[model samples]
Target: MAAVETMVRVGKAAHGRGVFAKRAIRKGTLVGLVQGKVIDDAEYYSDYCIDLGGTLSLEPKTPFCYLNHCCEPNCQLLLTEKRNKDGSLAPSTVHVKTLRGIKLGEELTIDYAWDSVKPLRCLCGAASCRGWIVAVNHVFDKSTAY
Candidate 1:
């Protein structure tokens, strides 16, 4: 394992074992890439998996993938749609680094509202932390948007 990965480990924090930022990460920097093989959403749903990005690989796992869900996230893992050479859709991810610095013990979190599912409650205890990580539209549905 790389020294970076060694700095991080998946363990229970608030909800369950979560990946934490071992070092201070700069905004817009590449935290890491999801090199795991792609799995269909169906497979993703069936597995009840904890890994993010709906893919799995044996490469050195980083704390970035273990980040829990938050209504308001410090950093964002954006999923972009790319057209394959065959004109098919391929989803890729890019990390939107946090505007501010995060301590080593802070949990790396992001809102998981891409689909129609409601956001999960957060336990990170940040003053602005929303109880749930809901869809942006739904977040506006309630009075949590600040």
Candidate 2:
């Protein structure tokens, strides 16, 4: 398949830098791969790192690293398994795909599914805003926005 154009750009966001769609993107389209070096879980914190299941993380090297978290995200991360040169099966690829049709200039976001290690105060402003972003299973009092 021909590469999809670089359909996103970096821009200001409520919290800080964020990724924005440069043009309308259809639902279920593959946004792109998360390019980066894999690191052990003990590295310094960076907003660009993604948890690659226990004890491992991906430090993104591309603009896609700027994607922010949203309670109601328009994109989702999917993992694909591949055979390494050594002939071992491993989950070696992560892809970002659109969850719904997005308008030009709209922010591209993903549900971080963040765990409680370092919860963040969410300001996504979505109607279903979870108040605080924590681990997927961690429950918090939602009476007040965190």
Candidate 3:
């Protein structure tokens, strides 16, 4: 395994500045915790394009926020649920891991369906890639497991 380090910088992917995995990540493992500067939803909205998979205000530290939403992602974002104002779930610590043995220089992304109803479009160019990224619950017929 490579040393735990910030191997990638926050920059533009399909969406925005998404950090990618620098090396192969094992299954059922922990990636970096998504702790970063607290970004207000209002501020993020003002700055960003405001897509379906944007501004996951779970704990301001969830890996889900860092893991850009991909239609054919190799990672999964598991959320520790907590009740929100409208009886909805909020993420505590979003755990990101490889769904399989991801190759080096690959972007570490996850399906945002665990939280969003419908996500944004993805242009990752995977063979089985879906045209758009949607939430697990609100996933479309073309929605596939990464």
Identify the candidate with maximal lDDT.
2
- The backbone clash count of each candidate, in order, is 3, 2, 4
TM-score of each: 0.61, 0.82, 0.56
Which runs of model 1 end up more than 4 angstroms from their true locations? 1-8, 41-65, 94-96, 114-119, 139-146
Which runs of model 2 end up more than 4 angstroms from their true locations?
1-5, 40-47, 89-91, 140-146
Judging by lDDT, tell me the better candidate of 2 and 3: 2
Which lDDT value does model 1 have at 86?
A: 98
Write the residue-wise lDDT of candidate 1 on 1-146 in tens digits: 13546344566766666767777766655555544445555444421223234343122234555666665566665545556699865555444356456667666666655433433455657676646555545533344332
- Point to the candidate with the largest TM-score: 2
lDDT, candidate 2, at 126: 91
Against the unseen true structure, what C-alpha lDDT does each candidate score?
Answer: 0.52, 0.78, 0.54
Position 49, candidate 1: lDDT: 28
By summed lDDT, the worst window of 10 consecutive residues in model 2 runs over: 137-146
Please give, for residues 1-146, the per-residue lDDT of candidate 3 as tens digits. 23336443454566555766666667666665545453437435422122323354533333235557666777765555556799864435544556876666667776554433344556767776655565444645444334
> Candidates 1 and 2: which is better by TM-score?
2
RMSD of 1: 6.0
Q: Output the lDDT of residue 66, model 3.
A: 51
